[model samples]
Target: MNLTPNRKEHREMSTIVSRVRAAYARIEAVARPEIWIDLRPQAEVESEARAIADRVTAGEQLPLAGRLFAAKGNIDVHGLPTTAGCPSYAYEPEADAPVVARLRAAGAIVLGSTNLDQFATGLVGTRSPYGAVRNAHDPARISGGSSAGSAVAVALGIVDFALGTDTAGSGRVPAAFNGIVGLKPTRGLVPTAGVVPACASIDCVTVFARTLPEAEQALSFMASPSARDLPPLPQRAPGPWRIAVPPRDQLGELDEGWAEAYEAAVEQLRSAGAEIRTLDLTPFTEAAAMLYQGAFVAERYTAVGSFVDKAIADGAADLDATVTGIITRARDLPAHQLYTDQDHLTALRTQALSELADADALLLPTTPGHPTLAEVAADPLGANARLGRFTNSTNLFDLAAVAVPSGKVNGLPFGVMLIGPTFTDDRLARIARDLEPSVQLAVVGAHLTGQPLNPQLLSLGARLDRTTTTAPVYRLHALATTPPKPGLVHVGEGGAEIETEVWRLPAEGLGRLLAALPRPMTLGSVQLADGTSIPGFLCEPAALENAEDITTYGGWRPYLGS
Candidate 1:
């Protein structure tokens, strides 16, 4: 279930259709129907993939070429019926939602549609009538919703990436539970014209991917030039940010494991050079409650109240009771109260801005804890509310968030969310990247893309950042090892621009990576052509005395003509 990036396969191993076939096979092998509400027929998926491949063959520059993805059933996919987690409310769309169209145009092929908390109403995936989307790591745990299925699809590797629409934390919570990256971009940055509304005014189309760069690639392609973005999303410079976090006492109650994970993430950031500031998120918390507890709950009603009303009158409603209760309660809710709540919301939003006025982003746990399906079943509302302890206010307060895996809690995946001011998506992402627990590794030999040792990187939670050369400053040697490994030695003269790949992995795994290396090889920093230094495999001078200097070949994979 590790969704690590395999640069080798992506760059050279398979055709787009073949990849689609493998994905279909993977889906069938998993045989988990609850993960999806409706899977596009395998034939149709392949057909679309072939078309994409043909376009690429014709010289189209498709950044997402052959990338497989799925959509939250609520987002329209041309031929699929938009269900928004309510099967009874399904409607076929004549064209793609702007987001989906953008992805397709970039060469991504849709595999199917995923389930969600019906009507995108709940944070716990259990609210879905399609069957609760199970956690990718543990079937018994909740998958965190209302974008449950989209997160699962990516976590399960059924697709390279997937789309989810977030109103509250639907895009982020599920990612926390599944141990992947979820980006809930600035609202309206991507068109929501063809999506089923959850809380329309605040809803956003979110992306879930195994890595940050992968998600960034998709985001860049989907940003609409004409979006009347309120805050005017500026492409800000990535920063050495001042991150805000709730005071320890204000973090609310969380399991020891999760609490520890949260602290570790903050410490990691501190170690990485970010200034951590303690703050009270009372205003942000209040804004979050306003979405449901206050009159903003009326927004949900305004969206689907009529349909639910008619269904109730006809005795044909099959919606979850919780969803029914919340939406219906707002039907006869006083207009004056709604208006009054809006006024209060303005104050809360303003307070929210002041709370972190000097900070670049707010770093917090993605959720308080992971709840099991049974626990959620016993106290659905309470459990669901707790799940959003750190997420509910983002949209209402006009903030942007990116949830990234922190580590684990009780052997289950745990994560932290980095939120920034509206339109500071780039800045927030910069902070998240800085927060990523990774060591930049330069591999030149068996570990280069498609080489024998490439799997080692993928197994270490590593993803290829890019491939370049070592600026004629390193000599490559064919080391004497059973697997014929290569060793790189920094040379001051007569060196060549040896090709290398910069791989990124969790910094914590550096020890394991070193232990797995052959006796003569060591991990050391190597300088790239751009002058950036990165940890790379190095050679013992003694070991290289009898080794073959294969510097002429540039890199090991090519030395083998691979």
Candidate 2:
């Protein structure tokens, strides 16, 4: 499921309804009941979409007019009951949570309410009485959770985007496992008033999308002014940014595949113009441990302990036993323990943030590795804890994070998270966008390595992916230009394979390159020798009328020597 941006437009009602129907068809095909605790009927959703379309036709500037989304059950949606992954605790909300309402006001329609770990307790998706939300990529593995269903919904393309909550990586872990983008904004940047709290003070309403821009777009509309007086954004000049990473020796026993993927991600970042710096993350890891292993566990109890206690007393509680133990055990903690832990955290947060003072963000593997359902079942606590080894600390320190896909490991998705200081949300987003899939562009002439105009591509941050040749169906012409430029034209009957180089650049850079291209040169699909086509340099037939035939020379470099 390649999740690309859905076109945001004032589309027709019929088109909107059709998209809704297609989504329903996809949902049926997926057959993952645990993903949704309460889904609106297809007809009902289509009807609302029609109304939204009507409003857009009336000249409403709804940015998300044609988009569809799902809300995590812990976040209130008007017609659905808030389950927080516990059926016995369900309750209907009077209106949508402020975050959901903002999205709806912008013309996005909600399809339903998705699942999560019960009480948002576990990092693994299995701690749900709604049944475990399986990974979108592989059912046998766990979908890293607390926000399990929301991430899976976006990954499966059932909806354009979905809402989730992140306290202890609920918003990030599932995205890494499912290959989607999770934007966890700085704490309190978005309101959590209507959400079922796990640790109310640090919990964030998160956005999950197939791409960073979409998640950023959602967050734009979702955010309201916060009382937290964040310092103005740093006045930094644009050039290569400094990015921090944990030293290789300190990364701690990563699965081989994940380690390789992390190293590749670092190189990718470096290629994208980041200066890599090694920093020990011992303090950061220690802060992450404090979230659950120390007095902070009491906050989770403070958030939902009474409800769980009451349910247990009534004998109507159908809860995950592990979640039960963690929350209940915190009930008797002395008040002084929280203050003591708070002091400890203040010291740790200061130390950890200082480590990133000179860097744009810290990049780390989102998790150690993918875990199988059986593996988690065999060692639930250890498996769940390990899943949060790289997450779980962001909000505790009031930081912002964006988790983006970083290739794959053993056919499963792997991802890396960029953590930045508080209020650096916009900055972090810009860096993360560069980490998304790069465009594969094939070039035949000037943009190739060691050519007159090659620097233009390099300036736009393009990296040569490979040097290959076109299928034996293209003719090469020496164009009459200020500087010698080659024109590639497809001639089915009498043509020769032409040398070409494929460069990978961020999608935004590709757009800029296309806009600045000269008239005689154009970009179109060029078939490679392997029978695959990618965007490559091409020319108008008219421009080649007075050009010299260079097919005999095979390539520009060879022709230059001749």
Backbone clash pairs in model 1 (N, Cα, C under 3 Å; residues 3+ apart or in different chains), count: 1
lDDT of 1 by residue, 1-562 (tens): 2222454334322478788998889888977788898888988877777677666655678878888899999889898898888878889999999889988888888888999998999998888778988999999999999988889888887887899988889999999999999999988888888889988999999999887766777888878755863645445356666889888888889977877889899998898898888878898777777777878788888789999988888886568888998899977778899889888988988887888877888999999899999999999888888887789999988788999998887889889999998787887877787666687898888787787788767655577889899977888888767567888888878888898899888674566588657678888889999988988888888898878888888788778774
lDDT digits (tens) for residues 1-562 of candidate 2? 2222232233367678888998999999999988999999888888898898877766788988868899988999998999898888889899999999999999998999998888888888889888899999999999988999999999998998899999989899999999988999989889997899998888999999887767887899999766488678778766688899988887788876788889999998899789999787988888888888888889888898998899889986588898998999988888898899899999989999788878999999998888889999999988988888878789888899999898888899999999998888888988886687779999988778999899878755577888889999999999877567889999888989888899987665577589768888988999999999999889998998878999988888888879
Q: What's each prediction's TM-score?
A: 0.81, 0.81
Residue runs of model 1 more than 4 Å from their true location after superposition: 1-14, 229-239, 445-562
What C-alpha lDDT, on a 0 to 100 scale, does residue 261 get in candidate 1?
Answer: 85
Give the best candidate by TM-score. 1
User: Candidate 2: which pairs clash?
Assistant: none
* lDDT score for residue 533 of model 2: 95
